[model samples]
Target: MRSMLKFAFRFIKNDGHRVTAKCKAEGCPWSIHASKGSATQLISIKTMNPTHTCRGAAVSSGPQATGSWAWRGKESAQEHLQGSHKDAYSQLPSLCDRIMETNPGSLATFTTKEDSSFHRLSISFHATLSGFVQGCRPLLFLDSIPLKSKYQGTLLTATAADGDDDRQNGLQEPICEIFKGSYHGYCLRCIAEQLVRDLKGQCSQEVKRIVIEDLHHADFAPNPEDFNASVERIKKN
Candidate 1:
Protein backbone atom coordinates (compact mmCIF):
# COMPACT_ATOMS: atom_id res chain seq x y z
CA MET A 1 0.00 0.00 0.00
CA ARG A 2 2.83 2.43 0.79
CA SER A 3 4.59 1.61 -2.48
CA MET A 4 1.42 2.14 -4.49
CA LEU A 5 0.86 5.51 -2.84
CA LYS A 6 4.49 6.42 -3.42
CA PHE A 7 4.27 5.51 -7.12
CA ALA A 8 1.07 7.53 -7.49
CA PHE A 9 2.63 10.56 -5.79
CA ARG A 10 5.80 10.25 -7.86
CA PHE A 11 3.76 10.24 -11.04
CA ILE A 12 1.50 13.09 -9.91
CA LYS A 13 4.08 15.41 -8.37
CA ASN A 14 6.74 14.71 -10.97
CA ASP A 15 4.75 14.51 -14.21
CA GLY A 16 1.48 16.29 -13.48
CA HIS A 17 2.60 19.34 -11.56
CA ARG A 18 6.14 19.49 -12.96
CA VAL A 19 7.13 20.17 -9.37
CA THR A 20 10.73 19.66 -8.38
CA ALA A 21 11.48 16.39 -6.66
CA LYS A 22 14.17 16.64 -3.98
CA CYS A 23 13.26 13.20 -2.72
CA LYS A 24 10.02 11.49 -3.75
CA ALA A 25 10.48 8.71 -1.18
CA GLU A 26 10.79 11.24 1.65
CA GLY A 27 7.68 13.39 0.90
CA CYS A 28 3.92 13.28 0.90
CA PRO A 29 1.78 13.52 -2.22
CA TRP A 30 1.35 17.21 -3.19
CA SER A 31 -2.07 16.65 -4.70
CA ILE A 32 -4.34 19.71 -5.08
CA HIS A 33 -7.16 18.45 -2.84
CA ALA A 34 -5.02 16.00 -0.83
CA SER A 35 -5.61 18.10 2.31
CA LYS A 36 -3.25 20.34 4.27
CA GLY A 37 -5.36 20.63 7.41
CA SER A 38 -8.66 22.12 8.63
CA ALA A 39 -8.79 24.35 5.53
CA THR A 40 -8.30 23.59 1.82
CA GLN A 41 -7.23 26.18 -0.76
CA LEU A 42 -7.87 25.28 -4.37
CA ILE A 43 -4.96 25.27 -6.80
CA SER A 44 -5.53 26.76 -10.23
CA ILE A 45 -4.68 23.40 -11.91
CA LYS A 46 -3.57 25.33 -14.99
CA THR A 47 -0.40 24.42 -16.83
CA MET A 48 2.68 26.07 -15.40
CA ASN A 49 5.66 26.98 -17.52
CA PRO A 50 8.42 24.39 -17.30
CA THR A 51 10.90 27.06 -16.29
CA HIS A 52 8.83 28.23 -13.33
CA THR A 53 7.57 24.85 -12.16
CA CYS A 54 10.27 22.39 -13.15
CA ARG A 55 13.44 24.46 -12.78
CA GLY A 56 13.15 25.37 -9.11
CA ALA A 57 14.01 22.91 -6.35
CA ALA A 58 10.89 21.10 -5.30
CA VAL A 59 9.08 23.00 -2.54
CA SER A 60 10.01 21.34 0.75
CA SER A 61 7.49 20.58 3.43
CA GLY A 62 10.46 19.68 5.67
CA PRO A 63 11.56 16.14 6.48
CA GLN A 64 8.91 13.46 6.94
CA ALA A 65 11.33 10.50 6.76
CA THR A 66 13.23 11.80 9.85
CA GLY A 67 10.00 11.38 11.85
CA SER A 68 9.33 15.13 11.68
CA TRP A 69 7.05 17.22 9.34
CA ALA A 70 7.28 20.90 8.40
CA TRP A 71 3.48 20.95 8.07
CA ARG A 72 3.44 20.86 11.88
CA GLY A 73 4.65 24.49 11.92
CA LYS A 74 2.36 27.41 12.81
CA GLU A 75 1.62 28.22 9.12
CA SER A 76 -0.54 25.72 7.29
CA ALA A 77 0.38 24.64 3.73
CA GLN A 78 -2.68 26.50 2.31
CA GLU A 79 -1.72 29.72 4.04
CA HIS A 80 1.81 29.53 2.72
CA LEU A 81 0.56 29.05 -0.86
CA GLN A 82 -1.99 31.87 -0.59
CA GLY A 83 0.61 34.24 0.82
CA SER A 84 2.96 33.59 -2.11
CA HIS A 85 0.16 34.11 -4.64
CA LYS A 86 -0.91 37.38 -3.05
CA ASP A 87 2.63 38.71 -3.26
CA ALA A 88 2.75 37.97 -7.00
CA TYR A 89 -0.68 39.52 -7.63
CA SER A 90 0.23 42.66 -5.72
CA GLN A 91 3.48 43.13 -7.65
CA LEU A 92 1.87 42.67 -11.07
CA PRO A 93 -0.59 45.56 -10.67
CA SER A 94 2.09 47.89 -9.36
CA LEU A 95 4.33 47.15 -12.33
CA CYS A 96 1.44 47.62 -14.77
CA ASP A 97 0.41 50.96 -13.28
CA ARG A 98 3.97 52.23 -13.51
CA ILE A 99 4.17 51.22 -17.18
CA MET A 100 0.88 52.97 -18.02
CA GLU A 101 1.98 56.17 -16.37
CA THR A 102 5.44 56.24 -17.94
CA ASN A 103 4.32 55.49 -21.48
CA PRO A 104 1.10 57.18 -22.58
CA GLY A 105 1.82 56.82 -26.33
CA SER A 106 2.60 53.13 -25.92
CA LEU A 107 -0.81 52.36 -24.37
CA ALA A 108 -4.27 53.89 -24.30
CA THR A 109 -6.24 53.93 -21.06
CA PHE A 110 -9.90 54.88 -21.25
CA THR A 111 -12.72 54.17 -18.80
CA THR A 112 -15.89 55.43 -20.48
CA LYS A 113 -17.21 54.85 -23.99
CA GLU A 114 -16.53 58.49 -24.92
CA ASP A 115 -12.76 58.27 -24.31
CA SER A 116 -12.44 54.95 -26.16
CA SER A 117 -14.24 56.40 -29.20
CA PHE A 118 -11.75 59.25 -29.76
CA HIS A 119 -10.40 59.08 -33.34
CA ARG A 120 -6.62 59.43 -33.02
CA LEU A 121 -5.76 58.38 -36.58
CA SER A 122 -8.04 61.03 -38.11
CA ILE A 123 -5.79 63.58 -36.47
CA SER A 124 -2.68 61.69 -37.66
CA PHE A 125 -3.79 61.71 -41.30
CA HIS A 126 -4.24 65.47 -41.21
CA ALA A 127 -0.72 65.72 -39.81
CA THR A 128 0.74 63.68 -42.68
CA LEU A 129 -1.24 65.55 -45.37
CA SER A 130 0.36 68.81 -44.26
CA GLY A 131 3.62 67.64 -45.88
CA PHE A 132 2.02 67.31 -49.34
CA VAL A 133 2.19 69.70 -52.34
CA GLN A 134 0.46 69.79 -55.74
CA GLY A 135 3.02 67.54 -57.47
CA CYS A 136 3.81 64.88 -54.81
CA ARG A 137 1.53 61.81 -55.03
CA PRO A 138 0.88 59.91 -51.78
CA LEU A 139 -0.95 56.69 -50.94
CA LEU A 140 -3.54 56.17 -48.22
CA PHE A 141 -5.53 53.26 -46.84
CA LEU A 142 -8.10 52.66 -44.05
CA ASP A 143 -8.95 49.55 -42.05
CA SER A 144 -11.26 48.60 -39.15
CA ILE A 145 -11.00 46.55 -35.97
CA PRO A 146 -13.61 45.15 -33.57
CA LEU A 147 -13.68 46.20 -29.92
CA LYS A 148 -14.19 43.85 -26.97
CA SER A 149 -17.74 45.14 -26.74
CA LYS A 150 -20.32 45.39 -29.54
CA TYR A 151 -19.84 48.81 -31.08
CA GLN A 152 -19.13 50.01 -34.62
CA GLY A 153 -15.78 51.84 -34.58
CA THR A 154 -13.19 53.02 -37.10
CA LEU A 155 -9.37 53.29 -37.05
CA LEU A 156 -7.59 55.73 -39.41
CA THR A 157 -4.26 54.56 -40.88
CA ALA A 158 -2.04 55.72 -43.72
CA THR A 159 1.46 54.96 -45.01
CA ALA A 160 3.97 56.25 -47.56
CA ALA A 161 1.72 54.21 -49.90
CA ASP A 162 4.22 52.80 -52.36
CA GLY A 163 3.93 49.53 -54.32
CA ASP A 164 7.51 48.46 -53.68
CA ASP A 165 7.30 49.38 -50.00
CA ASP A 166 6.59 46.15 -48.16
CA ARG A 167 6.09 48.18 -44.97
CA GLN A 168 2.85 49.55 -46.41
CA ASN A 169 1.32 46.10 -46.97
CA GLY A 170 1.11 44.54 -43.50
CA LEU A 171 -1.51 44.85 -40.74
CA GLN A 172 1.28 44.86 -38.15
CA GLU A 173 2.19 48.47 -38.88
CA PRO A 174 1.53 51.10 -36.21
CA ILE A 175 -2.11 52.16 -36.62
CA CYS A 176 -3.56 55.38 -35.22
CA GLU A 177 -6.58 54.96 -32.98
CA ILE A 178 -9.99 56.44 -33.86
CA PHE A 179 -12.93 56.95 -31.57
CA LYS A 180 -16.58 57.81 -32.16
CA GLY A 181 -17.72 61.32 -31.20
CA SER A 182 -19.61 64.39 -32.41
CA TYR A 183 -16.41 66.38 -33.02
CA HIS A 184 -15.19 64.02 -35.77
CA GLY A 185 -14.46 66.83 -38.23
CA TYR A 186 -12.01 68.48 -35.84
CA CYS A 187 -10.48 65.10 -35.15
CA LEU A 188 -10.19 64.41 -38.86
CA ARG A 189 -8.38 67.69 -39.41
CA CYS A 190 -5.91 66.84 -36.67
CA ILE A 191 -5.18 63.49 -38.32
CA ALA A 192 -4.34 65.23 -41.61
CA GLU A 193 -1.82 67.55 -40.00
CA GLN A 194 0.02 64.69 -38.31
CA LEU A 195 0.17 62.84 -41.63
CA VAL A 196 2.02 65.75 -43.19
CA ARG A 197 4.58 65.90 -40.36
CA ASP A 198 5.14 62.12 -40.59
CA LEU A 199 5.72 62.21 -44.37
CA LYS A 200 8.18 65.07 -44.20
CA GLY A 201 10.29 63.11 -41.73
CA GLN A 202 10.12 59.90 -43.77
CA CYS A 203 10.80 61.21 -47.29
CA SER A 204 12.61 64.31 -48.51
CA GLN A 205 10.45 64.66 -51.66
CA GLU A 206 7.26 66.73 -51.50
CA VAL A 207 3.87 64.98 -52.01
CA LYS A 208 1.92 65.96 -55.13
CA ARG A 209 -1.02 63.76 -56.24
CA ILE A 210 -2.69 62.10 -53.21
CA VAL A 211 -4.49 58.87 -54.12
CA ILE A 212 -7.52 57.66 -52.15
CA GLU A 213 -10.55 55.57 -53.04
CA ASP A 214 -13.88 57.26 -53.76
CA LEU A 215 -15.27 58.78 -50.53
CA HIS A 216 -18.95 57.86 -50.53
CA HIS A 217 -18.75 58.90 -46.89
CA ALA A 218 -18.39 62.63 -46.35
CA ASP A 219 -15.18 62.13 -44.27
CA PHE A 220 -13.60 60.44 -47.32
CA ALA A 221 -13.57 63.69 -49.24
CA PRO A 222 -9.91 64.85 -49.47
CA ASN A 223 -10.33 68.39 -48.20
CA PRO A 224 -6.89 69.92 -48.68
CA GLU A 225 -8.25 73.29 -47.53
CA ASP A 226 -7.92 72.48 -43.85
CA PHE A 227 -4.43 71.10 -44.48
CA ASN A 228 -3.48 74.29 -46.33
CA ALA A 229 -4.82 76.45 -43.54
CA SER A 230 -2.62 74.61 -41.05
CA VAL A 231 0.42 75.21 -43.31
CA GLU A 232 -0.37 78.94 -43.59
CA ARG A 233 -0.63 79.10 -39.83
CA ILE A 234 2.80 77.47 -39.54
CA LYS A 235 4.32 79.99 -42.06
CA LYS A 236 3.32 82.99 -39.89
CA ASN A 237 6.13 82.09 -37.48
Candidate 2:
Protein backbone atom coordinates (compact mmCIF):
# COMPACT_ATOMS: atom_id res chain seq x y z
CA MET A 1 0.00 0.00 0.00
CA ARG A 2 2.82 2.45 0.80
CA SER A 3 4.60 1.68 -2.50
CA MET A 4 1.39 2.09 -4.49
CA LEU A 5 0.55 5.42 -2.79
CA LYS A 6 4.22 6.62 -2.77
CA PHE A 7 3.95 8.17 0.71
CA ALA A 8 5.01 7.25 4.26
CA PHE A 9 2.36 6.56 6.87
CA ARG A 10 2.51 6.18 10.64
CA PHE A 11 0.16 4.34 12.96
CA ILE A 12 -2.06 6.96 14.58
CA LYS A 13 -4.15 5.12 17.18
CA ASN A 14 -6.29 2.05 17.76
CA ASP A 15 -9.93 2.70 18.45
CA GLY A 16 -11.56 -0.48 19.77
CA HIS A 17 -10.54 -3.15 17.18
CA ARG A 18 -9.83 -0.69 14.32
CA VAL A 19 -6.32 0.60 13.60
CA THR A 20 -5.84 4.02 11.98
CA ALA A 21 -2.80 5.11 9.93
CA LYS A 22 -2.02 8.72 8.97
CA CYS A 23 0.47 10.40 6.65
CA LYS A 24 3.74 11.39 8.37
CA ALA A 25 3.79 14.93 6.96
CA GLU A 26 2.85 17.72 9.38
CA GLY A 27 -0.41 19.66 8.74
CA CYS A 28 -1.62 16.95 6.35
CA PRO A 29 -5.10 15.54 7.01
CA TRP A 30 -4.83 12.23 5.08
CA SER A 31 -5.53 9.08 7.06
CA ILE A 32 -6.84 5.51 6.69
CA HIS A 33 -8.47 2.96 9.00
CA ALA A 34 -8.42 -0.83 8.95
CA SER A 35 -9.84 -3.71 10.95
CA LYS A 36 -9.60 -7.51 11.07
CA GLY A 37 -12.14 -9.38 8.97
CA SER A 38 -14.20 -12.39 10.00
CA ALA A 39 -11.40 -14.77 8.89
CA THR A 40 -8.48 -14.86 11.30
CA GLN A 41 -5.33 -12.92 10.23
CA LEU A 42 -7.32 -11.15 7.45
CA ILE A 43 -7.06 -7.35 7.53
CA SER A 44 -9.50 -5.18 5.58
CA ILE A 45 -9.39 -1.45 4.97
CA LYS A 46 -12.51 0.28 6.35
CA THR A 47 -11.59 3.79 5.12
CA MET A 48 -8.84 5.29 2.98
CA ASN A 49 -7.71 8.73 1.93
CA PRO A 50 -8.90 9.29 -1.64
CA THR A 51 -6.87 12.44 -2.22
CA HIS A 52 -3.58 13.65 -0.67
CA THR A 53 -3.01 17.42 -0.53
CA CYS A 54 0.56 17.29 0.82
CA ARG A 55 3.34 17.88 -1.73
CA GLY A 56 6.03 15.34 -2.65
CA ALA A 57 8.75 17.33 -0.86
CA ALA A 58 6.90 17.04 2.43
CA VAL A 59 6.05 13.36 1.93
CA SER A 60 9.21 11.89 0.28
CA SER A 61 12.96 12.21 0.88
CA GLY A 62 14.17 11.03 -2.57
CA PRO A 63 16.01 13.64 -4.69
CA GLN A 64 13.77 12.89 -7.73
CA ALA A 65 10.60 13.74 -5.75
CA THR A 66 10.36 17.43 -6.53
CA GLY A 67 7.11 19.33 -5.89
CA SER A 68 5.63 22.10 -8.01
CA TRP A 69 6.77 25.66 -7.25
CA ALA A 70 3.17 26.89 -6.80
CA TRP A 71 2.39 24.18 -4.23
CA ARG A 72 5.62 24.92 -2.31
CA GLY A 73 4.87 28.64 -2.29
CA LYS A 74 1.31 28.05 -1.03
CA GLU A 75 2.56 25.69 1.72
CA SER A 76 5.19 28.21 2.80
CA ALA A 77 2.58 30.98 2.94
CA GLN A 78 0.22 28.81 4.96
CA GLU A 79 2.97 27.93 7.43
CA HIS A 80 3.97 31.56 7.83
CA LEU A 81 0.37 32.64 8.39
CA GLN A 82 -0.23 29.82 10.87
CA GLY A 83 2.82 30.88 12.86
CA SER A 84 2.16 34.65 12.69
CA HIS A 85 -1.63 34.88 12.80
CA LYS A 86 -1.58 37.04 15.93
CA ASP A 87 1.15 39.31 14.50
CA ALA A 88 -0.85 39.70 11.27
CA TYR A 89 -3.91 40.81 13.27
CA SER A 90 -1.84 43.41 15.05
CA GLN A 91 -0.31 44.76 11.80
CA LEU A 92 -3.64 45.02 9.94
CA PRO A 93 -3.92 48.77 10.46
CA SER A 94 -0.37 49.46 9.28
CA LEU A 95 -0.89 47.13 6.31
CA CYS A 96 -4.06 48.94 5.29
CA ASP A 97 -2.32 52.30 5.62
CA ARG A 98 0.64 51.15 3.48
CA ILE A 99 -1.70 49.79 0.79
CA MET A 100 -3.57 53.09 0.49
CA GLU A 101 -0.33 55.04 0.54
CA THR A 102 1.34 52.91 -2.15
CA ASN A 103 -1.70 52.80 -4.45
CA PRO A 104 -3.61 56.06 -4.64
CA GLY A 105 -7.42 55.86 -5.11
CA SER A 106 -7.45 52.24 -3.82
CA LEU A 107 -9.92 51.19 -1.14
CA ALA A 108 -8.98 49.04 1.85
CA THR A 109 -11.29 48.38 4.76
CA PHE A 110 -11.38 45.92 7.62
CA THR A 111 -13.38 45.26 10.75
CA THR A 112 -12.12 44.03 14.09
CA LYS A 113 -13.62 42.75 17.32
CA GLU A 114 -13.54 44.65 20.61
CA ASP A 115 -10.37 42.73 21.51
CA SER A 116 -8.74 43.92 18.21
CA SER A 117 -8.87 40.53 16.53
CA PHE A 118 -9.55 40.35 12.78
CA HIS A 119 -13.17 40.05 11.68
CA ARG A 120 -13.27 40.86 7.96
CA LEU A 121 -11.12 42.52 5.29
CA SER A 122 -12.00 43.90 1.83
CA ILE A 123 -9.88 45.62 -0.86
CA SER A 124 -10.62 47.13 -4.25
CA PHE A 125 -7.63 48.11 -6.33
CA HIS A 126 -7.66 51.45 -8.16
CA ALA A 127 -6.67 50.00 -11.57
CA THR A 128 -9.26 47.23 -11.41
CA LEU A 129 -12.05 49.63 -10.49
CA SER A 130 -10.98 52.11 -13.18
CA GLY A 131 -10.94 49.40 -15.89
CA PHE A 132 -14.38 48.20 -14.88
CA VAL A 133 -15.89 51.70 -14.86
CA GLN A 134 -14.30 52.68 -18.20
CA GLY A 135 -14.56 49.55 -20.35
CA CYS A 136 -16.68 46.75 -18.86
CA ARG A 137 -20.42 46.21 -19.23
CA PRO A 138 -22.96 47.28 -16.60
CA LEU A 139 -23.79 43.68 -15.57
CA LEU A 140 -22.13 42.31 -12.42
CA PHE A 141 -21.87 38.69 -11.27
CA LEU A 142 -21.27 37.84 -7.60
CA ASP A 143 -20.16 34.52 -6.14
CA SER A 144 -18.55 33.10 -2.99
CA ILE A 145 -16.49 29.92 -2.56
CA PRO A 146 -15.28 28.29 0.65
CA LEU A 147 -11.60 28.66 1.51
CA LYS A 148 -9.64 25.46 2.30
CA SER A 149 -7.30 26.58 5.11
CA LYS A 150 -6.84 26.15 8.86
CA TYR A 151 -8.73 29.43 9.33
CA GLN A 152 -11.97 28.53 7.52
CA GLY A 153 -13.68 31.36 5.62
CA THR A 154 -15.42 32.27 2.40
CA LEU A 155 -13.82 34.22 -0.49
CA LEU A 156 -16.27 36.53 -2.19
CA THR A 157 -15.66 37.65 -5.80
CA ALA A 158 -17.37 39.97 -8.25
CA THR A 159 -16.94 39.75 -12.01
CA ALA A 160 -18.23 41.35 -15.19
CA ALA A 161 -18.08 40.74 -18.93
CA ASP A 162 -16.87 43.21 -21.52
CA GLY A 163 -18.34 43.67 -25.06
CA ASP A 164 -15.97 40.94 -26.30
CA ASP A 165 -17.25 38.48 -23.64
CA ASP A 166 -13.96 38.59 -21.70
CA ARG A 167 -14.28 38.44 -17.92
CA GLN A 168 -13.29 41.50 -15.82
CA ASN A 169 -12.97 41.71 -12.08
CA GLY A 170 -15.27 44.10 -10.13
CA LEU A 171 -17.37 44.19 -7.00
CA GLN A 172 -21.07 44.27 -6.10
CA GLU A 173 -23.28 43.63 -3.10
CA PRO A 174 -26.72 42.03 -3.16
CA ILE A 175 -29.44 44.68 -2.94
CA CYS A 176 -32.99 43.35 -2.83
CA GLU A 177 -34.53 46.80 -3.34
CA ILE A 178 -32.51 47.50 -6.51
CA PHE A 179 -33.87 44.36 -8.21
CA LYS A 180 -37.51 45.29 -7.51
CA GLY A 181 -37.56 47.85 -10.34
CA SER A 182 -38.63 47.16 -13.96
CA TYR A 183 -35.09 47.90 -15.23
CA HIS A 184 -33.94 44.38 -14.40
CA GLY A 185 -33.96 41.75 -17.19
CA TYR A 186 -34.42 37.99 -16.93
CA CYS A 187 -31.62 35.63 -17.96
CA LEU A 188 -32.37 34.16 -21.39
CA ARG A 189 -30.73 30.82 -20.59
CA CYS A 190 -32.75 30.53 -17.39
CA ILE A 191 -36.00 31.37 -19.21
CA ALA A 192 -35.30 28.77 -21.92
CA GLU A 193 -34.49 26.19 -19.26
CA GLN A 194 -37.77 26.89 -17.43
CA LEU A 195 -39.70 26.61 -20.69
CA VAL A 196 -38.18 23.22 -21.47
CA ARG A 197 -38.91 21.97 -17.94
CA ASP A 198 -42.51 23.30 -17.83
CA LEU A 199 -43.43 22.09 -21.32
CA LYS A 200 -41.72 18.68 -21.13
CA GLY A 201 -44.03 15.86 -22.45
CA GLN A 202 -46.94 18.35 -22.52
CA CYS A 203 -46.53 20.64 -25.56
CA SER A 204 -46.02 19.57 -29.17
CA GLN A 205 -42.67 20.23 -30.91
CA GLU A 206 -44.29 22.90 -33.15
CA VAL A 207 -45.73 24.83 -30.18
CA LYS A 208 -42.46 24.56 -28.25
CA ARG A 209 -40.53 25.86 -31.25
CA ILE A 210 -42.83 28.87 -31.64
CA VAL A 211 -42.82 29.72 -27.93
CA ILE A 212 -39.04 29.43 -27.60
CA GLU A 213 -38.27 31.41 -30.76
CA ASP A 214 -40.73 34.15 -29.73
CA LEU A 215 -39.24 34.36 -26.25
CA HIS A 216 -35.75 34.75 -27.72
CA HIS A 217 -36.95 37.44 -30.12
CA ALA A 218 -38.66 39.32 -27.29
CA ASP A 219 -35.58 39.14 -25.14
CA PHE A 220 -33.20 40.39 -27.83
CA ALA A 221 -35.57 42.92 -29.47
CA PRO A 222 -33.93 46.25 -30.40
CA ASN A 223 -36.77 48.41 -29.10
CA PRO A 224 -39.55 48.25 -26.51
CA GLU A 225 -42.27 48.22 -29.21
CA ASP A 226 -40.70 45.19 -30.92
CA PHE A 227 -40.36 43.47 -27.56
CA ASN A 228 -44.07 44.03 -26.73
CA ALA A 229 -45.11 42.88 -30.23
CA SER A 230 -43.06 39.65 -29.87
CA VAL A 231 -44.63 39.02 -26.45
CA GLU A 232 -48.15 39.45 -27.93
CA ARG A 233 -47.29 37.10 -30.79
CA ILE A 234 -46.00 34.51 -28.31
CA LYS A 235 -49.29 34.70 -26.36
CA LYS A 236 -51.35 34.28 -29.57
CA ASN A 237 -49.20 31.35 -30.73
User: Model 2: which residue pairs collide?
Assistant: none
Where model 2 places Cα greater than 4 Å from the true spot, the runs are 1-83, 167-237
> TM-scores across all candidates?
0.18, 0.37
Residue 55 of candidate 2: its Cα lDDT? 62
How accurate locally is residue 23 in candidate 1, as Cα lDDT from 0 to 100?
26
Q: Give per-residue CA lDDT, model 2, range 1-237, as digits (tens).
A: 445446776777654455677878787776756665665533445675534567633544333433332234333333432434455567878888888999999998888879866788888889988878987888889999896544677899888776444621222122335555435455688889888789889878898898999999998899999999999988786
**lDDT score for candidate 1 against the true structure:** 0.35
Candidate 1 TM-score to native? 0.18
